[model samples]
Target: MSTSTSTAAADRTLVTALRERLQLDTGEAVSLVETHISWVLLTSRLAYKLKKPVYLGFVDFSTLAARKHFCEEEVRLNRRLAPSLYIGVVAVCGSAQAPHLGEGDPIEFAVCMRRFSEDALLQRLVPAGRLELDRLEQFAHRLASFHGRAQIAAPESEFATPDQVGRPVVDALARLRVDAGARPTRDLQTWIFEQRKALRTAWFARQRSGAVRECHGDLHLANVVLIDDQLTAFDCIEFDPALRWIDVMSDVAFLTMDLEAHGRRDLAFRFLDAYLQHSGDYAGMQVLRFYEVYRALVRALVGRFRVRAGAAQPGGPDYLACATRLARMPNSAPRLMLTHGLSGSGKSTMAAALLAVAGAIRIRSDVERKRLFGLEPHERSIDHPTNIYSREATERTFARLAECARTALQAGYPVIVDAAFLRRDERLLFRALAAQLHVPFSILRCRAGEADLRRRIVAREAQGRDPSEATLDVLERQLATQEPLDPGECAAVLDVATDAPVDVDALGARWLALSLPPITRRPAGWSAS
Candidate 1:
């Protein structure tokens, strides 16, 4: 037999031996789960994953030593995120006929892990409508924080190079050409070529600026589970550093694409906005669509492989449709909207609610102001309290917000500035920016009764959970100096009664209707491939 066939046969023999004789607390027969790259034997509480001795070009676990090294690597790397899930690397010893685990000279190796309930996976939760927005927001916060602290790729490394980034796309496209229709594959390749050129400078700049990092290579919903009501990410790509060390936005796009594939575009946008809010990576949005399409194609290729292996999968066509949909520009043109409100008038809340429907990014003055002083969203600025809220600091904060809004708008994304645009000049600054960019501009005038605003601010302060550091004193200052909209400005305003229930969807639709359509560069008659 050929070497690969022989290796496969040996791996099967070892797996079969382990399944029959492995001991567990449940006293039940050990069940096996097989993927293209590994074999996992499951007990009641633990899972032992053994790598298949196969070389897939991108990854190689074809030798005993390679498998052992990768097994240890898996444990080491995964512990960075989910330490409790990965117990350790354990040895599988003896011949295939009488395999032993963790007890003899190592003939094989397995990464032992604590098994979680399959039902708690985001994959199932999404379909069952059990996934809550709060949980997703928390996950976004954790992931953004993780990405911020992840190891930056070495300057000398090939990771995130233009060639390296495009290699996987080319490989997946080649496979898809054979499995999918020739015409669509060709069109997709053409679109990718154009997009790559458009985003070339951005890719290199991001790489140099440390946007590339060692990330969870496999961040799909399937690899994420809810343990003790926390979103836990596991099963990262340990076999290939090239895959694991990538642009952080590439990692973000995987879960974003998966969410869209599962028909939750609203949640996908919500997740992306939350991630952006935490990471302050607005520039990443420029290349986000490219990565989203690339991720979809990769998943499509995997689904095709799974179908060939006789496994039930979402099937390649579903992902292909998603990619095609993503490649098309947004239905409406990108516009800029400023939330006009005082402290506790619900500008932040209103901005968040309108994000999904408007397909926009929301930048908050409170968060960015704290960020300027190297503080987290909810962190106190006790050390520099006066400086943080000074008139000069306020000017800097509004300037920063304006810059962020410009970046998102230029990247063909609508933007909502969640700030107290109580000054006519502050509002005019963003309006001029929108005019300069030739995108539409409008205002969301959020209002609440004075008593209600004071009550809400007091309650928020007592809770100490919100990002705003605005106190009653701050509210009084805002009320004293706030500028009401002039007649001309009022003409462009979408009044939002914050104390009452607002139909964000209806409001978003009306706002978008007034904006100019986005400049889609394609010919007028062209259709989405």
Candidate 2:
């Protein structure tokens, strides 16, 4: 037999022996799972992942020392996010006929970890229709918090440089050509070059501003799981620092692209909007589309690999189509929408619904107001006390909202200012912004009765989870002084009744018709409503 075949045979024998002889915490039989690069031994309570003695261009585990180093690296890096899941590195010793998990002279290494239910994976949850928006929103907050504190790449590092950012995308395209036996379409090629050229400055700015970090390079839904009802991210790319050290937006794009691929665009936008709210990284949205296309192509290549292994049928072509669709940009320019309503009238809720179908980014006043004061979204204004809602503070908040709205609009994304636009000047500020940017603008006029508004305010206060600190007193004051849209402003208003159940799909459709310019063409499977 050839050397490769002989080595594979030996590796298989060793895996079988280890599975039979290891005395795991669970007394049940051990099951073995194989992948292109590794083998995992699953016991009831634990998992032992061993790298295959093989060399792929992107990774090398052919030598025992190399495997040992990567095993340790995996445990260390994955522990950054899923500390409880990774249990540290262990040795595989003894002869292949009598292998031991942690004994004798070490022949190999395995990263030991706590086993999680496969069903809890987001990959499974998406297809099963078990994924909920609330859980996804919570996960968004968790991921944003993690990203905020993740280690930033040094300026001297080779990561997130313009060259490095484009390398993987170029490589993914080359691999797709080879694997699919086809070149990318002319449109995709043109888009790739144009987007790369456009984002060069943004990439440099982001790198200087510490947007590049040691991130979870492989952040697809399959790598995320629900542990104890918490969305936990694990299995980060540890074999290659070049891949792991990337722009934070690239990391966000991976999960968002995967969510879109799973036909959950609404959830994708919800998660993204939530992350932006927490991280205040609206500036990163500029490069998001480029990274999204790259991520989709990477996934398409991965799908091809799985298909070659007879693991999936539609895996490759399906993702290829997704990449093509993602590459297709809207011919029309982006729009700006403002929410006009009192607190408890569901302005935020309507904004979220609009984003789901409109493909927009939402910038909320309450969130930005707290952020300006160095407070988290749900944090009380007790520290700022008297000045948290002062007229000056409100002015600052509106200015911040306009700033974020401009950023989003400039990034080629629709913008929704999800604030209680209770004043004419407040409304005019956004209108002027849209006019200055030369984008379409409209208002979602949210309405709720006084009784319903009072009840909602009380309930939201009791929950203590909303960013708004609006009390019944605040509502009463707003009711007394809030300005209604005049005749000219009424031309651009889309009325929404907040007291009754909202047909979100219908509202989204109406809002799009009233706000954005008509799309000349949509990608296959792309929907506006």
Lowest lDDT block of 10, candidate 1: 520-529
Please give the lDDT score at residue 312 for candidate 1. Answer: 53
Per-residue lDDT tens digits of candidate 2, residues 1-529?
A: 9999988899999998899886554567888888899999998888999999988888999899999999999998999889999999999999887788776899889999999889999999988899878889898998888889999999888898888888788888888898755467878878887888888899999999999999899999989999977888999998989899999999999999888888888788999999999999999988998888899988888777776788874532366666777788742357888999988999998898879887789999999999998999999997775687889999999989988888888988878999889898888877777766767788898999988899999999999999999999999899899998877568778889998888888877766665433532222333222
The reply for model 2, stretches above 4 Å from the true place, is 1-5, 23-27, 313-317, 330-333, 515-529
Q: Candidate 1: list runs displaced more than 4 Å.
A: 1-4, 23-26, 180-187, 314-317, 516-529
* Per-residue accuracy of model 1 over 112-206 as CA lDDT, tens digit each: 99988899999999988999999999999999999999999988788988888877787778778787442345567787888877888888898
TM-score of each: 0.94, 0.94
Each candidate structure's count of clashing pairs: 1, 0
